[model samples]
Target: MRTASPPRALVIVVVVLAALLGSAYALGRSLVDGVPEAAPSGGPLTAEQPTAPSTGPSASPDPYQQWPAEDGPYGARSTTGDARVALTFDDGPDPYYTPQALAALRAYGVTATFCLVGENAQAHPDLVRAIVADGHTLCNHSWNHDVLLGGRSRQTIQTDLLRTNQAIRAAVPDARIAYFRQPGGAWTYPVVSVSHELGMMPLHWTVDPSDWRAPGAATIAARVTAGTGPGSIVLMHDSGGNRQGTVDALYRILPDLASRFHVTALPPEL
Candidate 1:
């Protein structure tokens, strides 16, 4: 009654403006509550914890390191508990004598082990092939018969052995060299260890008739026959000098050896 409605339109306008303000305030609150908060500088966004660093030992050095630096193993001189004797000729494949020895061995129907000199084997590849063809085993004798070979560095020793083996395989492509004999039987720990690492048994001699000295044939025969026994590994030479004595000695010794103990080459596997 007093002021009257200044304008009915003005009243309507005020009501609409108030409704708009309320709607805006509600929308702002909804937006603020829905937004995600920023993560702290150094903290993880998710709840899962990180794993800690490991403190365990790293894997052991490759057990198969080439030629162990230090030596602990040694080669075998005689085989164990077998009633067999092995004839091993070294420094061999001589053009003059190895064939003779082979013939004598063939006559007796015997197989033998030849620890061949690298140079000699290379020179007489035919003999190496003959050795394999006759079912004999091969042993690696260092290239030059270096008596102090084992005293050299591991790499040197390894190289010497590998080179000899290479020469052997060059002659008889599939030759199975099962043993390694250091020149002059100068076996050191390094020599033995490296040999075994190379998949060969270390070979030492139980019977050395000193035939390399070119003793008389009768003397060589007597020595070999007297010294040989079950499990004996007799060492002789087919080269490195006149070996007529060795050839003749073999003719005598092999027949007696066959009649007594079972003379044979080394077992194919160690």
Candidate 2:
């Protein structure tokens, strides 16, 4: 005999229950898979996390940024960008005249910048020390005062500037040579660019008295005082020959310059 089939109502109830169970299973799987995993302990921060802002002192401003940019010969700086006047002496650190210059500066309570030659700095480290000791700014004037330094190859110019800087630092151990002045004011693009690469400002002058010619003290003094105005970088010399006139002229120039304008050395940390 054949077996009897199940009732229709029972079959329908069983089918409905099986369908509900399958739907429930799918919903649960989706819920579990959609959740994101947590980051590991002590791991790097995730995108949702942000770093805190710093609370210490802000970085110092670049002094050169405020300077006026030159049009030709590669952006050399001539002015001090303010009412202050800068007195820069070139080819210096001579044993005889440097002392006199320093004495005059000391007497007037004024400081100036010294653009030194490599050989001179090397030979007279004591004078370099004195320049630093007097709190004057330092500049690299090239090795041996080569007027044709800017016309040479880039590497040659860079090497010469670096060697001069090295000689300067050897004397003071912590000299801050912030400027490079080409000898004879013979500035070129290569020299200026190399100076920037070496972390120095290419310095020029506004007022030149031709004091390097050993002009009489009265003449040097008259020219400097008359030519100088606000933001002037007066070019004078302390070495390269007898600088007695330049030294003596300082006695007259400093008093008048100090009285008229705010005279100061170029910043050592440009």
RMSD values, in order shown:
20.1, 15.4
78-148 per-residue lDDT for model 1 (tens digits): 55246789999998878888889889999999999998889888888999998889988899989879999
What are the per-residue Cα lDDT tens digits for candidate 2 across 1-270? Answer: 999999999999999999999988877887899954545567768777766566556756544444447633458888888889999999988999999999999998999999999999999999999999999999999999999999999999999999999999999998899999999989887888889889999999988899878879999999999999999999999999878899999989999999999999999998
lDDT (C-alpha, whole model) for all candidates: 0.84, 0.90
The residue pairs that clash in candidate 2, if any, are none
TM-score of 1: 0.72
TM-score of each: 0.72, 0.74
The lowest-lDDT stretch of 10 consecutive residues in candidate 2 is 63-72
Give the number of colliding residue pairs in candidate 2.
0
